[model samples]
Each structure stands twice: as structure tokens, then as C-alpha cells.
Target chain A: MSDNVVPMKRTGEATPSLSPILSLTATAMNSVNQVILDRMQSEIPLIPALAGHLISGGGKRMRPMLTLAGAQVVGYQGTRHHKLAAAVEFIHTATLLHDDVVDGSETRRGKSAANIVFGNPATVLVGDFLFSRAFELMVEDGSLKVLKILSSASAVIAQGEVDQLTAQRRIETSEERYLDIVGAKTAALFAAASRIAAVVAEREDAAERALDDYGRNLGIAFQLVDDAIDYDTGTADMGKDRGDDFREGKMTLPVILAYARGDEEERRFWQDAIAGFRIDDADFAHAVALIRRHDCISATRERARHFAQRACDALSIFPDGAARRAMVEAAQFAVSRGY
Target chain B: MSDNVVPMKRTGEATPSLSPILSLTATAMNSVNQVILDRMQSEIPLIPALAGHLISGGGKRMRPMLTLAGAQVVGYQGTRHHKLAAAVEFIHTATLLHDDVVDGSETRRGKSAANIVFGNPATVLVGDFLFSRAFELMVEDGSLKVLKILSSASAVIAQGEVDQLTAQRRIETSEERYLDIVGAKTAALFAAASRIAAVVAEREDAAERALDDYGRNLGIAFQLVDDAIDYDTGTADMGKDRGDDFREGKMTLPVILAYARGDEEERRFWQDAIAGFRIDDADFAHAVALIRRHDCISATRERARHFAQRACDALSIFPDGAARRAMVEAAQFAVSRGY
Candidate 1:
């Protein structure tokens, strides 16, 4: 995973280099992350106790950075931006805890998952705690619009999770349905975070929509990349066991698309592997090879790039500032990062 | 268990002449229950498919009735009362679904539990959907105060559940801690329902306090009775298996208090049954005998009655109206009903 951290630029882009933007983003994110950690430690003491092991176990804090960067790009100067950033992190943490429980994941980021450490009941209830605490923090912002956006997003995300659970291992699941699930479960929060920042900054409607669009597109790109990496990357690169999604019968985008295009033998393998849950190592390897042979990985990666480009397009409406430049760079970084 | 139904007076006073009040309360509850079924059916089109299964699966709907009675007693004439009542029911239903999943409960209300039918993931996520839908209904009321109350209660209830999970099976759990958990997890919503009714009715401060106290005390009594029934009732009587609390390692008030007063043998029985998870039918019977011999069942019953009396006390501050009389009767019913 560490070996995949490339510099934040494409090799052939003729756009002027923006090193200062990256530096500003890093500085802003550092302060925002600190605020988030401190608030999480104080407000949800149990979270720090439970998540401390995992926090140190390592995560990129990418969501917090997105929020902070989004706020900064729109010229947000108030300290409330810090609170919003922390709220974003809390929401993300809550979802991760619940997701691991739902997935029955034993390891996350190469460390024992929360459910593995504290048990599923503790992991689930604590996840509820973080979600509630996130709402309390959002309420403190005193923006009804922000509250509405966040509350609605949370509802959508939860529904999306249920939709995925219902669709798991179902041979009838389509790529469009898979994308819809991803959009609600993963992208809604990202979009809410970015849009809330713009709302807090009191940006014009167009700017708010642009930032929201940027976040929505970036979130889709990020999730697609994640799904694609599950097939292309090894366990060492992904920091967890590879092919667990297929083993668990989850119909991710690549799997759904590949199954749609497979030959009779390949299709039978896919059905037995996912639908029948006959996911031996050889079958996992076969599914991976089948996805690659079907050009699903490259196709999915291209789809991610398309969304990344759309994310960049949303920023065109923004003034040329350090934050705007960083936003553009971050979208590209999202696509370029290895699984 | 049916034979043991304590035939205490329907009113806390030494009078059996409160039959009118009981009948009025019953009629009001019947109407409210119908409204609840209608609204739940209207909103969930899948109700026809699932309602018979869920409704026949038997729940007391105590929380929803509390909401309706609370609103009626506060003189709220608006149609929003029904929505609030349904909101309470939805929240309660959500909790029950999640509770069954967390406890791995196979039976509820003398039938197969939802998780036993739909699987754990579905139960958990559907529970989440109910909660989200509850919030959506609350938002439609357009009362930020109600939203705030319900939201805070939701958070506190979830936190209480987490606290219970962390403290489960710990022999060191105290009665005070147990009370805290029951108050937050069970009574908080009850209090919120009544308090929100007052807020909606724009009542006087004294009236609001009276209703809030009534609801809180009623909730405490309700939970106390529930805990006691775990020892005194069987599956056929209680609609679910007895000794479930013990099996789940939950440290209810009676158990905590009993453990404090237990002899060495009894203490060992509890330790093995709960903390060590070595419970058997023999252990359950032994535990029941110990509880009876120690008079813990009677002691717990007295405490429940005390809370019921306190609930009636809150109503003395209200006017001599039918609603107030019904509220008083309901409290008595909660404590003295089929044991």
C-alpha cells in the first residue's frame, strides 16, 4: 500500500504544476484532522478507546481532507469548518464500523476489525453512538439546510446498505443497480460533506451545486476504484484478504459486469462462486482471471477516470485558488492511487 | 404464569371501583391502536405482505399508546398526534428488530422472530430503515423541538444499548447502573413521546412537567415488570421464552440485586450461568428458585408498583379530565396487569 503513494500529478497534463495547493491542503487537513481527533476523543470517549487501535492501525483520513479542502476552496474562514470536518470523519467512522459488522470482516486495513476486537454487538452499538454523535455535532452548526442534507443523506446511505444486502449473491443484479447502491451508501455522505461546506461558506447556488457534483462524482470514482482493485490488487496491496467480496457473495460492479458477459463455462463458475457460494481459492482465482479477461478491470478504471474528469469539471466554476487547484489534483490522485 | 397474574387494584388507591377509568383507557387505546395500524399500513405498501406476519408476531405497542395517551391528556387536538404516535411505534419496532438480532433471539411473541426468518443482515438494515422512516415522519411535523427531542432520545437509547453490551455478564454491575441503563434505553423514548406532546400542544410548563414525569415513571415501571416476568413467566405466558435475559447475560435490576444478596452457591450459579455462559435448564430452574426464595420477585414487584404510584402522582397536578383519569389507570395497568 505504501509503495503505491505516487506524487499528486499525471505525467502528461499540460496544466501548470500546483505544489502550493497540495501544501495548503495538507496544512488545512492537518489542523482539521487534529480538531476531528480531539472532538472525537472528548465527545465519544468510547470511540477513541475503540477506534484508537484502528486509527493507529492506519487510514488515509481522505474524507476529512475532502471536507476541509472543500471548505477552504470556497473561502470558508470560520472555525465551524473544523466542526463540519470532524462531523464528516465521525460519519465515515460510524459507517466503517457497521460495514465491517455487516460484511463479517475479520480484518480491516491489515488489523483486527472492531467487531473482531469488541464483538459484533459492541461494534454495532458503538457505530450507532458515532452516528448519533455526528448528528449532534451537525445540529450544533445551526444550519437547517446542513441538517436536512445530512439527515437525508444518512437515511439514503442506510437504505443503500439494505439494498446491497438484498442484492448480495443475486444473479439478477445489474451494473446500474450496483452503481445506485454505491452512490447512496458511499457517495451520499461525500456529497453531503462537500455541499455542507459550501453551504457554510454561503456560496451561491451554482457553486454549491458544483462542489456537490464534485463530491458525488469523486465518491463514485473512489468506490469503483475500490471494487476494481479488489480484482486487480493482491492482499498485500489492498491491506486485507483479496476476493473476500466475491467469497461473501457481494455483487460488486466488476463482478456484475463480468458475469453479464461470461461464456457458458465461465458463467457457471461465476454462478457457483457467487450464487452458490462455492468460493474456493481456485474459484476466486478463476473469477479474478475472468474479470480481467473480460476487460472489466480496465473498463471499470476508465469509468472511474470519467467520473474523476467530471469531478474536475465541477471545479471549473470556482475561482483559481489554492483550494481549487488542490481539489483538481485530489480528484486525479483518487483515480491514480493503487488499490 | 397466567395463574400468577397478580390481581392488584386497577387504581393504586384501595378501591376496585376504577373500572370506568379502565374501560375508558382501553377504548382510547383501541382507537389509537387502530390509527397506528392504518398509518403503518398506508406508509408501508409491503405491509400486506409482512403485516400479518409481524402483527401476529405480537408486540405490546406500549410506546405508541403512550404517545397517543400523552397527546390526548395534553389536549392536543391536531391530527399530528397520530403521526407522532406512529413515529413512536416505528422507533420501538426498529429497536425490537435490532434487539432480536443483537440477542440472536429465535422466538418473539410466541412465533419465529424476524431475524430467524429474514436473516441478521436484513433484520438489522430493516431496523435502520424503520428508524429513518420514523425520523422522516417527525420531520414532516415541522417541529424542530420534537425533532431534537426524538433525535436526542435516539442517541441516548443507542448509547444505553452500547453501555449494556459493554457491561453484560459482569458480576460487578450495580443496581444503580442497571437503573441508568433502563432509564436511558427504555424510559427515554417514553419521556420524549409525552414531552413532545406537551410541546405540540403548547401547554403550560407545569402540565408539561406532569406529563413528562408520568411517562418517565410509567416507563420505569413497565421495564421493571418486564424484567421480573423473565423469572416469573414462561414462553406461553410472555410470548417469548423465559430466562432470555439470563441467556443474553443482561444484568437486570433483579439479578444484580439478587446477586448482591446471594449465598456462595447461588453466586456461583449466577456466575456460571451468566459470565461463563454455562446456563442450562437446571441452572435456570435453580436461579428461579433462588429468586423466589430470596423474595427478589416480590421486592422487584414492589419497586414496579412504586413507580406506578409515582406516575399516578404526576396526574394529580392535571385537571379532573377523562384523559387524566385514563392516564392514571394506564399506569396502574402497567404495574398490575397479567403478571
Candidate 2:
């Protein structure tokens, strides 16, 4: 997995060597991740019988790591960090369950999805269960601010999903519309999960705003990179098949940009392959080749890097700490994985 | 619709006279039902074009009416009642969207269901959108109590759905479990809506408890009548095809109770029909007839009446206002529909 990727050096960067910070962040994130898994197991009994197979099937756990790292950057040592981490994971899981059902996806992470195994009804209801359980856990935290933030994020995510459905296969979707969907459906939760840590830690207004901005930028960069990976990565390395978004007719940024730049013939190809119901391997190959020819992939990667840079800049207000250093490093890693 | 049903009299018995209270309640309910339909129309622009057709196809808007009647019973003059009514309606619509997907139901209200029309993905996401919209509206009321009640009810309803999935096709399911599922999934929201009035009015604790009990019992009775109607009514009146529950191997209360009292041969028939995966119209007819032979329908109807009576008893704690009287009559109407 690391063969094609060259790790960037930090010589000219604002941050110094991140080796120690990255190591510590990794340890803290793993601990919090374990706590999340444990809490999910305890709360959802059916998780072991049905969901456990998927939970252990191998996921990046990137969202939960971001949450834990966010709490760490704010110097949060309280046990509630565990709850926040679990909340983030639950939100992530809920989205995945609904996504599989929405996309009619059969396999995920190289294994049959919950919908495929337990059937769509169980998957949908279990997803609802996870969402409700997340709320219950948040309520137990007894923070009105946290509740408000999480609830609002939940709404935004749902609205974004609906927006995606409405905009699917629509070649006319603007970059602004695409960003809005990604921001709401993906980045919003990431941003909220991180920003919530400052609120929980009772940080000052300046500190809170900085972390919030950092989280928002990092989330955008993270999603952009994820979208790029869906196009760039291999099926085995990605733990699932590539071209899934294209197969589902989702109008991601690369497709939108490529379709916008395409000539009459290219546009016709897109219409036939995506909108006009002609989806075969040849269509997928043409779509991918067209995207590459338009340099949309590189353009998208550059955009992701811009957000990553902004994320690092947002953390400048933080005191010199290992967690802050790791935050910057993680943003870089998001972009690096795409190359 | 009202021809054979005996109207309730002042002496708590059936009478030939047309009940003015019932007429008034129906009038008020119809007014609120119109409000619900109008509000659903306002949200059409935010949803897919197909959603409008699916939603407006032919929903009965029964739950919204219950919310309106609940609020009116307390003489709630505030316009917030309409918002709450819409919220309840949104929740009901959301549940229906998910239910259609879960059951793979193609037709609802005599037209295509949202899932069938827009596909499962759109239906599920739109359901999420509706639920989020409901929460947003509830939040606007600026009542934390209402938010808490509604959110909790949503969680319970979600749990009940999961419980039903886990228990599906299990012929050994107990009567107690059946009530639990129905109470949580169906009655909880009704109970929450009615009890919310007392919370909003800042009424006495006893009054709140009474309204809550009234709503809960009313909901149970309402669902029992609905279950009975599934077996008794024709496709035209019911709006959707019937006998799917038995075909799908769902063990409703009547089936569970009938199975418990059946002879060995009769038990074998049910086993083959439900557990042995053999279901046809003949099997469905036989199951219904068996339930009838065991007087399960009448027994269930009596249970429903008991709940309705309990709901009426709860209302006795309130003053004898027209609204209260209407609520009492409405409860009677709920159970007496089949007779």
C-alpha cells in the first residue's frame, strides 16, 4: 500500500518532525477507538450476532480517530472523550448502513454488507437503532450544547443525503452544489465531532473557533481525498470495489468537473454512460479515461491539499503541543494517501 | 363508513342516536388533517419530484388528527399546536417511508409507494429528511420538553422496529412481547402527543399523567382495530392489498393468541403456513378463520374496548369541556369502527 506513495518531509513546513506526535496520536486514537467498539458492543446486543461481522471486517475508523484526536488537541483527559468518540463512530456507522441500502451495495470492506447478510429491513432498522442509541448516549452526557450540535449535524447529513439523491445523474450540477452536498453529508459530521471537543472541554472562545475551523477544513480535505481514492485506489487496497460511486450514478466532483469540460462527443459519452442507462465496463473505462484526460483527478487532489493547508493554518493558534502537531500531520496524510 | 357502527351514548353504551360529539370531533379532526396535507405540500420543493406524487397519492393522515384532537382537548389555542401536529405527521410519514422499504411494499394508498416509485434509496433518504424536518420544527417551538418527549418517542419507535425484525417469523413470540412492540412502535407517539399538551399548558401533574395514559390506551386500541381491519376489510377500503403480513410470516397478536389455543392439527397448519414457509390465500384464509373460530377477533376487540374505556377513564380527571368530551367520543369511535 505504501509502495507508490512517497512520504513528504517536514523540513520547510511550519511544523517540525511529527514522528513522535504521530505515534502518540495513533496510540491515543487506538485506545479511544477500542473504547468506542466496546461501548457499541455493550449498547447494541445484535451487533455481536449480526453487526459484529462487519465492525471487525476492517474499516479505516478515520472518523473516530479524528474525534479522539480533536479531543486530544484540546487537552481533554476526561472520560467523556470516550463517549464523544463512540458518538462519532455511531454516526459514521449509521451513515454507512443507510448508504449501503441507498446504493443497493452488496459488498463492503471485501465482505457482504449488513443489508446483504441480514436483509435490508434489519440493516435499515439497525441503522435507526444506532442513530437513536447515539442520541441516548449524548443525552446522558447532559450537555445541551453537545446535543444541539450533534442533532443539527444529524439533520444536515440527512438533508445532504436527500440532496445527493435529487442531484444524482444530473450532469448540470455545479461545483457549488457538489461542495454543499459533500460538506453536509460528509464534512459536517467530521467538523462537528472535532469542534464538540472544545465545547466539552470548556475552552475559550478563540480556542474553540480555531479548533472548529481546523476541524472543518480537515473534514473537507478528508472527504475530497476519499472521493479521489474512490477513483484512484485498487479494489484490494481499498477493501472494496472501485468505481462504486460511478456505478451508482453519483455525480461526484471529478465527474462533474469532467462533464463540464467535455466537448459535444465527450458530453454524449457521459450522458450515455451515466444518465442514459448504458453502464458496462467499457462505459466505466471511458468515464475514468475521460476524467483523467480532463485532469479532474489532479485538480481535485489540489483542492484537497488547499483545504489541508488551511486546516494546518487554523491550528496555529494552539499552543505548541504534540496533539496540534499530529493534527497538522493527519491533514497532510489525508492528501498523501491519494497520491 | 359509519353505517353499521353503533354510536356511543351518555350511559357508556351503544345507542341509535347520531352522536353530536362524534360529529364535532370528526369536523375538528378533518380541519387538522387538511392542515397536515397543506404543510406536506409546502415541503415538496425540497424533495424529489417523484416524492410529491407518492406522498400525496392517498395517505389517511390519521395520526395528525390524533395530535390535533389531543391538543384541542386541552383547549390549546396557540398556533404551536399546528406545528406539533405537523411534526407528528412528519414522523408518521417518515415511519411509513421506512416501513415500505422494510416490507418491500410496492403499493400504498392505492398508488405506488415512495420506495417503489423513487427506489429504496430515495425513499429511505427522504424518510430521513422528513424526520429531520420534524425535529427542526419541534425545535422551533422552543420547548425543550416537547423535544425530549418527541426524541425519546422516536428512539422507542426505532427500538420497537428492531425488536419486531428480530422477532419476525418466530411463532413462539409471547402476547406480552406483542403488546410491548405495539405499545412502543405505535402507542408511544400518540401518548407523547397527548401528554405534550399538558406539558405545554403547565397543567397539574395528575392531569399530565391522565392525558398520557389516555393517549397510550387510545393508541393501543387504535392499532388493534387496524390489525383487525387488515383481515376484515377489502383492498378498496384498506387502500393497499391485504394478507401480506401472514405471507411475510409476521406474528401479530391474533396469530400468536390463536396458535396458543389451537389443537394439534390446527397448530400443524399454522406451523406449515408460517414456520414451514408455505403461505397462500387458502392458508391465509384458514388462519383468519381459525382465529375467528377461537373468537380471537372478538377477544381482541374486547381488549381494544377495554383500552378505549381506560382512555376515557383517564379523561375523567379533566374538566367536562367540549374538547374533553370529544376526546372521549373519539376513543369510543376508535374501537367501535368494526362493529
| DockQ top scorer | 2
* Per-residue accuracy of model 2 over B1-339 as CA lDDT, tens digit each: 232222234564563221544454465555555655554442235564544565566565556655666666666666566677677777878888888899899788778777876788878877776676676666666567777777778778877787777677888888888888889889998888788777777677786788889889989998887777666633246564667678777778778878999999988887777774668777778888898889887777788888888887787766566666677777877776755
* lDDT (Cα, tens digit) per residue for candidate 1, span B209-259: 877788888889889888988988532375757889877888887787788
Each candidate: chain B TM-score:
0.87, 0.87
Error of 2 at A186 (Å): 0.8
The local lDDT score (0 to 100) that residue B49 gets in candidate 2 is 55
- Which residue pairs in candidate 2 have backbone atoms (N, alpha carbon, C) closer than 3 angstroms, thus clashing? none
Model 1 lDDT at residue B326: 67
Q: Please state the error at residue A6 of candidate 1 in Å.
A: 22
> What is the C-alpha RMSD, rounded to one decimal, of candidate 2?
5.5
